[model samples]
Structures are given as C-alpha cells and as structure tokens.
Target: MIETRILTADDWRTWRELRLAALTEAPDAFGARLADWQGDGDREERWRARLAIPGSHNITAVLDGRPAGMVSGVPGPRGDTAELISLWVGPEARGRGVGDHLIQEVERWALRCGVGVLRLAVAPGNTHAGALYRRHGFAATDEPGDEMASGEREIIMVKYLTAEDRTARDVTAGDLSGGCAPPADSAGCAPRADPVPGG
Candidate 1:
C-alpha cells in the first residue's frame, strides 16, 4: 500500500535524495538544476526554510516503508493561489498511480488551506506529464515558461478550486477532477502565475 502524509523533519534526507534524483533524471521538467542547489553553504537551512513555509506542503508516497513518489506546493503571492512544485515519481513507481496520488494529495492540501487556485508548469517535451495534468482537469494558460536546458518550451497550467465560479467552495482532493473542461492549445486561455519562484 502507498501511504501519503505531510513531510516531517526526519524525512529531509529522503526528500533531498528524491529531489536530486528528479533533478538529475528530468532536468527539463524542473526549474532548478542540481548544480544550482548542490554545494550550497547552507543547504540544511534552505531545506528547513522550504519545509517551514506556512502555506507550503509536501506529500510523499511511501510503499513498503520506502519513499516512491512525492509532490509539493507553496502559496503564491496571491492569497488564494498556490504553485505546485517538485513533483516526481521513482523509476520503479511510475505507472502505478503514484503520480496521480501525489497530485491528488497536493490538491487536497490546497483546498484544505483555502487556496482557490493551483498552478504548475510542464516541459513541452514531457507529454506524459502534460497529459496527466490534463486528465486531472488542469487547463493550459497563455503564459510560457522560461527556456529549458533542453531548449524546449514549457507550458503553464492552472486549476480553479471553486464551485459556481463565483463562490469559494471547500475543495477536496476529489473535487479537482469534477466538472473540469478540456483545455485548448490556443492563446486565449486565462493567464497563470509564474511557475518558477524566481523566474
């Protein structure tokens, strides 16, 4: 069974290891590279700060007591928005619903924290991830991401966590996929927040 829970201090090592793996394996998918994070003088402090943000949440998928996948989100500058980040699944864990569960867990955390919108970015070459996000109701935004290491573009996507489009509803993990419309690859979609923090 895969268990999902909030990341704790003790999980820092696992978090760091999985993050390094993601950065190394899927360089284009994430904004930060291993070189940008490695050998930082205050690596521990940075990890603590990341784990300490009030609106930030990390969920890890543990199978047989080992971490297999993880996802995290932090509040955006806007009060009702959050940015999904550091999403990844181990090589052995892919195609087993781990990615979906991680995303669903992030959605639940966003709703529980009163965030009405969730934003993310995907490398244009990462069709699998793009399709997964689309299947879960995320719509592409008009904004484009920064140039990736692989020279391909990235696309921004967002999901609104409200009912009736006027009133804020208590969103749950299951609500993310409820009544979501397919996204068109046109330029008229709504604008989305920057996916990378310093981008």
Candidate 2:
C-alpha cells in the first residue's frame, strides 16, 4: 500500500535524506545540485528553511513501509498559482503509484488554497517526467521558466484549476488505489499556513 505523509519543518531530517538521494540518483532532474546541499551547505538550519518555505506544503510517500517518493508545493511566482517542485520517486517505487499519489496530494492542497493554476518545470529531455505531467493534465506553456545552472531553459507546464476540476478531484480523492500505477517520474508546489487540514 502507498501512503503519504505531509511534512513540516520539524521533519527536516527526513526531507534532507530523501532530497539528497534524489539529487544524487537523478542529478539531471533538479535545478539544485547534490553538491550544493552537501559539505557546509548541509546544515540543519538550511534543511529546516527549505521545508518551511513560508506557505509551502511538503509530502513524502511511503510505499508499504519505506519512504519512496517526495514532492513539494509552494506559492508560485504568481499569487493565483502554486508551483510543484522537487518531485522524485525512488527506484524501488518506480512501477508503483507513488508519483501519482504525490501529485494528487499536491493538487488537493492547491484546490484548498483556491489557486487557479498549478505550475511545474520539468528538466529538458526528461521525457518520462514530461509524459507523467501530461497525464496529470499539465500542458507546456510558451512562458519561459527559470534558467538552469547549465544555462538551459526548463520546460514549463501548467494545469489550470477550475471548479469542475475540483469537483472531479473531490470525487476520486478518497480512492487511494489511483488506478494502474504509472511509471514513476522524477519531475518537478502552494498554499496557506494550514493549507491542508488533518494532513
């Protein structure tokens, strides 16, 4: 079974461990390099600050009994939107529905925040990640995203949130089976102080 746990600054240690693993395993998938988070940069305060990104929501997925995936939703560049960031699924959980669960959790959080759009930037050439986002209703936009350290522009994708979308999500939110498990993709945020009640 796949279960998700909403994390907070207090869970920095857990977040730190999974984040380092993601950066190391999928070095090309994230904007932040693993080396950036190591050495002196690997301070406890830094990890705490990341998890405490003002109005951000952090989630880690547990497949059966092990941590298998992580994702974050933070207030976007625009107030009406939220950004999904730092998405990663462990190798052991790739064929499972962990990625879907993580994305759905963030979508629920965005709906509760009343955000009109959810945005994300997938690294160029990460086709699996791009297709995964597409399946979840995100589409590429002409708008440019942040330039990576390598000076390449990431592919920006956005999913517009509407009343109808919310209604449909509400109906299926409780169905944890998430249908067939899509191949987990490492792609890669929103919300209020208490965005998601009851975690």
Candidate 3:
C-alpha cells in the first residue's frame, strides 16, 4: 500500500535525501540543476526557512515505510488554483502506483485549499510523465515555460476541479497542515508560497 504524508519542518533530512536523489538521477526533470544545491553550507537552515512559509506544502509517498516518491501543490494567484510541482518517483518504486497515490494526495490538499484549477509543467519529450499527467486529467494549454538548461522546453497542462469533485474527497480545512491551509478567504486569495521551496 502507498502511504502519503505532509513533510513538516522536522522532515528536512528526509526531504534533502530524496530531493538530492531525484536531482542526481533525473537531472533533466526539474528546473534546478544538481549543481545549484550540491554543496551548500546552509542547506539545512534553508530548508527550515522554506517550511515556515505559509501555504507551501511538500509531501512524500512511502511504500512499506520506505520513501518511494513525492509531489506537491501550492495555492496559485487565486486560492482557487494551484501549481503542482516537484513530482518524482524513485526508480525502484515506479509503476507500483506510487505516482498515482502522490497525485491523489496533492489533489486532496489542493481541494481543501479551495483550489478549483490545478496546473503543471512537463517537458515535451518526457512521454511517461506526460502520460501520467494525462491519466490524472491534465491537458495541454498554450502557456509556455521558460527554457531549461537541458535545452528542452516545457509544456503547460491544466486540470479543473468541480464542486462534485470536492464532495468526493472527505477532507476538511481543519485537518490540513497550516502550510497547506487556505487563506482566510480561500476564494481568489493570492498565492503566498510554492509547493516546493525553490521552484
């Protein structure tokens, strides 16, 4: 079974491990280069600062108590929308529904934050990841993402959530992390933070 949990400030160690692994293994998958975070004297302190930012939510997925994957979503310009990012599944755990569970959990968090629209950026050549996003109801939009160091560009995809969809998930605002909490007025509330720290 896949188990998902929000990453609190104390979980920085685990976050760093998985994140570095992702960056090393899939250098082309994210905006930040491995060099950007390779050897930082204040990495831990930086991570703590990241966690304290309100509306920033990072999550990890585990299988049998071992970290398997991660994904995150944070409120967008309007609280009714969010940008999903930092999706990564370890090599050993791919194709085992790890990604699915992560996406589901992020979606749940988004909904509780009053997010009705979810968006993501995926590189065109990354077919597997694109397929996964499509399976979860994402579709391409005209928006363009900045050029990557790898020279590949990003394509935007979006998904819309409806009232009926919110009803399907039994999550309430009270049970959510303060980091993932919706604004005082969730509707059209400005985005205060990102799901991932740097990107």
User: Which candidate has the highest TM-score of all?
Assistant: 3
Taken over the whole model, the C-alpha lDDT of each candidate is 0.69, 0.76, 0.76
CA lDDT, candidate 2, residue 163 = 82
Q: Rank the candidates by lDDT, best first.
A: 2, 3, 1
Q: In lDDT terms, how accurate is model 3? A: 0.76
Question: Candidate 2 on 136-183: residue-level lDDT in tens?
Answer: 999999988667777888889999988896665453355332211111
lDDT value, candidate 1, whole model: 0.69
lDDT of 1 at 164: 49
In candidate 2, what residue range of length 10 has the lowest lDDT sum?
179-188
Model 3, residue 97: C-alpha shift (Å)? 0.3
Off by over 4 Å in 3: 172-178, 182-190, 193-197
For each candidate in turn, the TM-score is: 0.78, 0.84, 0.88
Task: Point out where model 1 deviates above 4 Å.
Answer: 164-199
Clashing pairs in 3: none
